[model samples]
Target: MEHKIQPLLNYISKYIVLSKKDEAVLMSKLIYRKYLKGQYIAQQGDVCKYECFVISGCTKMFFADEEGQEHIVMFSIEDWWTADMGSFITQTPADYNVQCIENTELVLFSYDVIEELYTEIPQLERFFRKIIEKAFVASQKRIVRSFSLSAKDRYLYFRNQYPKIEQRIPQYMIASYLGITKEFLSKIKGQLIIDQ
Candidate 1:
């Protein structure tokens, strides 16, 4: 359990310096857990109480439309942090679901605990602020790409961005993330191969 936190500590150190006491406090608050593939870490309509840091494996954050179609919002892997931000901060129900795509290990922090940490270690607040800023920027870019790029172009971009992930998950999930049909993604991939 102590060793499991090294990845998270290393990630945080890249952004902010932590004193030994701060590191101890942070580690004490972390709850380590495991989830099997297809298990939900969070679900729509539930209050998102924990902000999770992935130690291993993959998870997807998604939401279903009224028509019951799931739209992939984001994918999180090793060293990535994930939570339904609005719900986690506001203490309200989540509009999205986060589920493991493979057996996963995570270090989780509850909302109150994180708030306490922020007060105890001001640097942690700065670190999380930077994390959210990057997340926002990536969200904006994704929105722009959806409007400006063709499906095939978007697929190519996604492949470039997450090459390892592309090989790990099902193609249908990738198509959903790209906002395209599985058949369409298959066709695009086939055409790209032929063109090459």
Candidate 2:
């Protein structure tokens, strides 16, 4: 578990170098968590306490409507961060639920600890600001894709963006993420195969 922290440390160091003492201070706040497949990391209406960095396995952030249909918002795998951003930052109920898609290992940092770390390590604040900026850019791209792309084009783009996800995630979940019916997704896949 200790060795697993190195890669994350390296990632943070790229944005700002941390002294050994600061590193130790930062490390002390992180805790390892394990979740089984199908477990909820944060459920709808729950306040998210921790923001998780995936060490291994995958998670999906989704919302279930009144009809019980799930709409996938995002997926996180190795080296990625996953959390209900609205809930985590604002300390409010989450509209979406984050669930593990596989046996997952994560390093979690609580909101309070993160704020204190930013105070103590000014560079960490800059690091997170840059991270948030990148996240916003990605979100903008997703919005553009949803508005401008056909379902088939969207599927193709999603495949290109996360090639490994097809093997890790369920077809129905992918269909949800693409904002299409499962049957339509199946037809799209069939057409793709025939075209190939």
Please name the candidate that would achieve the greatest TM-score relative to the true structure. Answer: 1
lDDT for residue 102 in candidate 2, whole number 0-100: 99
lDDT of 2 by residue, 1-196 (tens): 5687776887787778889888888888888889999998999999998888888899999999999889999999987889998899999999999999999988898999899988887888898888878888998999999999999999999999999888899899999999999899999999999999
Poorly placed runs, candidate 1 (over 4 Å): none
TM-score of 2: 0.96
Candidate number of the best lDDT: 1
lDDT at residue 57 of model 2 (Cα atoms): 94
lDDT of 1 at 103: 99
For residues 4-38, write the lDDT of model 1, one tens digit per residue. Answer: 78999999999999999999888888899999999
Each prediction's whole-model lDDT (CA):
0.93, 0.90
